[model samples]
Target: MIVRTIRVRTIWSVCVPLPLLSLMLVVFGLTTGEFVIAGILPDVAAGLAVPVPAAGRLVTAYALGMIVGGPVVTALTARLPRRPLVTGLVAVSVLANLGSAVAPGYGLLLAARFAAGLVVATFFAVAIATAVSTAPEGRQASAVAKVALGMNLGIVLGTPLGTLVGQHLGWRAAFAAVAALTAAGLLMVLRFVPASPAPTGSMRGELRVFKGRDVQLALALTAVGNVGVVTVFSYIAPLLTGVGGFGEGAVPALLLLYGAGAVAGNFLGGRLADRALMPSLAGLLAVLAAVLVLFWAAGGVRILAVPLVFVLGLLAFAIIPGMQTRVLTAAGAAPTLAVAVNASGFQTAAAFAGWLGGAVIDHGPGLRSLYLVGAALTAAGLGIALYVLRRDRRPSPEPGRRPEHAGT
Candidate 1:
């Protein structure tokens, strides 16, 4: 009887985090829909009767929508109830993906992709805020990590699978698959997620987070870190093919390794942040900078490049939970809007980094220069992190008020 009781308790302990699990699934579905386009661009171009380069614009459209939409949605829906809001976001994802699957032309497809992007960051902000708000005390970072785990899994599993499906079935089928997964996520969220009231603040109050130095610093840190990551990642295929001398077949396996590393980093980062947020963040950034430097130096050696790619992915993502936690903690009363804005910062950085990387490729530096650029960006981010840490050490103005440092 005692053995059975212990077994039941163990299962319950694992099962108690199902809300996070649901959020993960939702993230996975959304991320897959957002990223799968890269894998299916050729098919989309063929089907829409547009040039492949034109099809590439679908990605840019999505990023632009995410950049513009996240904060707007958060501000406009600041007072809406949480459960229905999340469910509605998933519903929007479902409908948007369906639109993508069935759209008849390039213009319609672009609209669908943009519409999908519009909700991606907003969903992340709300879902992450919900995850943190509902999490057990002392486990907020862990909850956020679990949510990110789904995204990593999507990168590891979903994009490849979508590509395979698009290769065999059709690109539209890939979007249809995304819609189906999103529908399942919708049902899970509606069934399992508990309702929470929105934070009691006006749009003006939520907007006030921008004025906080710590909040602005956090956003800058996220942007700098992401610029470092995306600068290489956006052009990883070319770097591998051009610099590493890797064949097309090896790219997927290499990316899988990176994704696997990301999964490990996600969970580890959350645990570390839960323990010592600022130090963990600083350490992760330092490691990331070092890895980027290593990648730049050894990119031509396959054995070295493969392992460094994994380490690069690990260090790159390990900072996410810490960054999110910092913003949320610093923002105090405006967690949702702060998170939304942070997501926007990341998207904007990704767009900017891609453009910068393209310029380097087109100009004299060539593809190998991307890693160097990435290293420089990460080093800059580390400097910002160090500055933030220094600021945290200063004494607070109020006698009883503790400084709003990273973890505390």
Candidate 2:
């Protein structure tokens, strides 16, 4: 008698390193939970018998949680081995999502979302740190990008799917789906991610990295650089419908297009940053500014505007790896804390962008004016990047790690 055995492998088994893949999956789950709320906001508002604006506080609460919780969690857990720490964080997230799924009122749901956000930024920080530490020399940016690619996928696939589930079943079903995703992610992380050595330094010593001017600059650059993209993205639905005259039904398809572009731009940016970090950043920012200006001029014309959405997404994401790499390189000694702080800075910038974009809409020229303001804001960020380029003249190498090249 002959016996045959069956084996199955997932697409995730492609080429990424196992540890990084595990980290990526965990990140994907967290990101899905973070973004799915937007898709289900109206349902949540109705379900809780609250005004849509009040229900909107969940988003703000989560951002606030990230800003406050990242440092606290990272500081408390900084010395632990990466595998368990990350898995533990994912576990906490699973519970938070479950709590969100069962929340009896808006207050409880808001708290659950905050709890969920508590782990996200620090999880990202640790995941990125582990990936970089394990990467081959000179591949730091690629490693960063791979972990970040999970985020893009979450936006592209997870959010939409979760939204679908919410629409068909109920909003609570979406949170349950997110919880299930995190649970699966926790298992994959435990399976594929190798146990890391405990950190050699204490939290206090690691925190000192922020004192460096380069580190400070990297953090500021991240916040300032993202404002342009956030300003447009926050109001994308309105922009498309109001100016481009696209029907509401068309927005989803256009967003999918944008997401596809983001995936492509992310990998491309990673490769470019691996080649020449600072220069690539500068060039991408300049291009992004130009694209924003082009978008402003073309937004009224559907034919031109549709393709610009893809290009806009491409340029917006193309700079992310460079921004992340700079921060990691600048604060090599304190990856966990530095990255958490960077996450907070980016969050703060997003919050500011929302306010600024609203002001532009309410008081300034009009809805069409958003793109111009976005372009101007992007130029301001580009100026900062250029200043860093001029001041550093060469990329600051990661601590104790040899400089890969002068161009970085």
Candidate 3:
């Protein structure tokens, strides 16, 4: 009896909460759908009778919707129950993906992609908030990271698989598969995710998070750093083929390496953030900048590009947990809204980066210059991080005093 009890306790300790597992599946499905477009852009363009550059705009449209949707949806549904809100969001995702699978024209497909993006940021914000709030004490960052692992895996495992499926079966089939996965995720959420009480705060009160300088700094860091990462990542397929001299058959293997690095970075960042948030963030940004420079210099050589791509993936994602933790910590009174806004910041950066990459490919120095652009943006982010660190060293304001100005 004693041995059995110990074994049961150990199993319980190792088992993840059902709600978290559900959220991870939702994130995985969403991320896979989002990134699969990048991998299969050529096929999609050919199928839709559009140029590849034009099809790339689909990514920008989706990102723009996320930038708008995160804060808008969060604010609008601030008083709703958590389970229903998340479930409904996932349901929307299923429909949007299905629409993508069947859309007959580029315009219709673009609309579907935009709709898909709209729900993703809102879902991610709610899921992260739910995961962190329900986590065991002192394990919040780890819990958040675990949910994010789904995204890392989606990149590592899903994108390559989806690309292969698209290559063999068709891009529409890939979107159909995502729709099916999201439908399954919706069922899991409905069955396992418990209802969470709405946070007690007026819209005005929730908006107070924007008043804090720390929160602003954190959001800015997210935006600029993501710009750096996405600038290169948005054009990765072409970069590998055109600049790295990689064949189409080799792209999936290289992506696998990058994805593996992302998985490692996700957990490592979570652990470091849990221990020391600010320092870890600053270090991650610095490493990211350095890695971007390295990628630019070595991209021409396949041998060097292979390992550098992996390291680049690692350093880029390592900033996420730290950034999320910093935003939540700084937004003491309005974590939910703050997290939503932070998600918006990331999407906004993604939109900008996508546009910038397209411009570079069309008119500027072309694909290889993406690395230089990424490095510059990352270096700027590092400067902001240093400023934040210095600002943190100053004495705190009086307990009852609120700052006079606060708006992002």
Against the reference, the lDDT scores of all candidates come to 0.86, 0.87, 0.85
| Highest lDDT against the true fold, candidate | 2
Regions of model 1 farther than 4 Å from truth? 1-16, 398-408
Q: Return whichever of 2 and 3 wins on lDDT.
A: 2
lDDT (C-alpha) at residue 71 in model 1: 89
| lDDT per residue (tens digit) for residues 1-408 in model 2 | 122221223344545766777778778888888889899999999999999999889999889889988788888988888877877888889999999999999889999999999988889998888788888899989999899988999999999999999999999999999999878877877887778877888777988788777888898888888898899999999999999899999999999999988988998899999999988998998999898888888888999999999998888888998898899888888877889888888888889989998998999999888998889888988998998898777666788986644322
Ranking by TM-score: 1, 2, 3
Could you tell me the lDDT of residue 273 within candidate 1? 94
Evaluate residue 65 in candidate 1 and report its C-alpha lDDT on the 0 to 100 scale: 80
Alpha-carbon runs more than 4 Å astray in model 2:
1-14, 394-408
Clashing pairs in 1: none
Could you tell me the lDDT of residue 38 within candidate 3?
Answer: 81
lDDT for position 404 in model 3: 39
Clashing pairs in 3: none
Ranking of all candidate structures by their lDDT, best first: 2, 1, 3
lDDT of 1: 0.86
Cα RMSD to native, each candidate?
A: 3.3, 4.2, 3.6
Residue 125's lDDT within candidate 1 is 89
Q: Estimated TM-score per prediction?
A: 0.93, 0.92, 0.87
